[model samples]
Target: MPRVTFPHVAESYRSFKMLMEDLGNEVILPPRPSKHTLDLGVRYAPEFACFPVKILLGTYLETCPKGVELIVTSGGVGPCRAGHYAQLHKKILHSLGYPVDIVVFEPPRLYPLDFLHNIQRLNPRRMSYRAIYECIRRAWRKLQALDNVEKLTHKVRPRETIRGATTRTYRRVLEWIDRAYSLVEIEEAERSALEELQKVPQDPNRDVLRVGIVGEVYVLLEPASNLEIEEALGNLGVEVERSLFLTGWTRDNTWAETTEGLTVKEAAMPYLPELLGGHGRDSIGNTVLYAKRGFDGVIQLAPFTCIPEIVARTILPRVSEEHNIPVLTFFLDEQTGKAGMTTRLEAFVDLMRRKKAARRPA
Candidate 1:
């Protein structure tokens, strides 16, 4: 049996980890990324690697000393560096003498059988098809539960009168959902979470500004690497909408079907007409969709040296000018400072407020 560990990019990852655990593997989750993790990644990662790759390297390094036998990670292949990330990570680990097995979950797009084969490695109970399907269903349920709670958090954070009230409630909600097993339990946890969140005193007329966050999945999902941008915006009294959700993304990729996101895809056609891979077009599409929905502003988060977002960044100003909405772009790296980022966020919120006021009838 393989003793496995993986990077914890977001709390939703807990859902995925639960999947691996239920599959009969001993899974070790690396600690949340911190200064120490960044330092380790920076020291070992090649110069000019994007912020995510370095932090991910740091994530694996932290797990190595714990005697993990396998480092399992999702894999991809395309026009972006992500296609090569797993191999690079494996090579780097071997170079450092870790010599651990790194299982990359190849998408069914490339080799139809690869996905099943990879999962079969964890099949201690005869690898029945029904068993594998059930494991995935449970994992999907957990992820969906987390996503629903997060959506509610986004809505409540801006209106909650008490500082950090929604954040505190959201943490508890996660634990509640994590403890749930069946679909009914998951639905119950979500309903209870929303009810609990509603108890927080909220100012219905607080002149809150709504902003949509769009960018690469790595930066979009990894709060630690992105400096907890969503929470920061919420605490600053801005309602934040994220462009990506793991449940939606998984269904789109695995099932080869577009969910409600297809409308966003169609909306983006006027600006970004091509599927540029690495979610470059989706970033463009999401911004356009939010702008049409009368959002106050949009924030584009990208990793330093990230090619896809770099492509998206060049076009955002055009979208902003056309839609009459402000756009702020942040390029995160090892040197990103909380103080500077906070200052920028404060200024952006102020601008949105003044602009909203100006638009009111005299």
Candidate 2:
């Protein structure tokens, strides 16, 4: 049995791990990213390659020695640099004398053709088509369940009467979900988790500042990659809202692409007014929408040298200036310092607070 491994980009890995287990393939996910992992990625990667490229590259590099016989990776088709990463990583890993076989799946990960092939390729035993399809359905449901629990965390974090209570509860709930044995068990975990989270007691009268986060999908969703910004913002007494989650993004690109006639380009109309891939238009639209919805500020986080977001970065200030909403753009590479990030975030929140105060009628 080949011991296969992949990086945990978010909660998506739990469901993926389950799916592979059901298919009879051995799956070994790399440990959560840390200083060591970041350093591993930066050392071998082309300095200008974006942050996610390093994270995944480093994740594979660090874990390759753990008896991994194969590596499962993903890519996208676009002008954006994302899809090119895995292809390059394969060459780099092979050059380093790691003999592990690397498999690349096109984006959405569960498209009919690629999804089936990925399963068959990784599995040592043959499975019925029904088994393959059913596994995907269950994995997707799990992704939705994870997102629901995460949304609750975002809502409860800022308003929780006790510091860190919501975060602690969220972590325990995640562990509970990971141990669940079935779909019903997962749902039960979610319900029980929500009940536990609600018990944390939020301050109803607390005038918390609200901020919206929008940016490159990986940086926005990967907690370690972003240095856990959501927790930082919540501790700063601000409510956090993110426009993308794993489930929503996969649904839109995989299933919803058939019906999404307007495209992200249309959503960002009159602002960016074009599609540059890597969610450029979506980022622009989210900033405008968040502004109209009374959010005090918007933060755009992305990897350094990310083309799509750099395109958005150029246009976001225009949206900020026009809509009168404060926007902060943070471009992160492995070199980003935590203290500096915290200081900038603190300053942004303070500025938004003063801005909000000025808007009130005397």
lDDT of 2 by residue, 163-278 (tens): 99998888888888788767788789878978888889899888899898989988998899999999999988898888788877532432243344434455579976666778
Model 2 residue 192 CA deviation in Å: 0.8
Error of 1 at 354 (Å): 1.2
lDDT of 2 at 304: 92
For model 1, the stretches where C-alpha displacement exceeds 4 angstroms are 249-262
Model 2 Cα shift for residue 152 (angstroms):
1.1
Weakest 10 consecutive residues, lDDT, candidate 1? 250-259
Cα deviation at 319, candidate 2, in Å, is 0.7
lDDT of 2 at 292: 66
In model 1, pairs of residues that clash are none
Listed per model in order, the count of residue pairs whose N, CA or C atoms clash below 3 Å is 0, 0
* True lDDT of residue 241, candidate 1: 81
Minimal lDDT window, size 10, model 2: 250-259
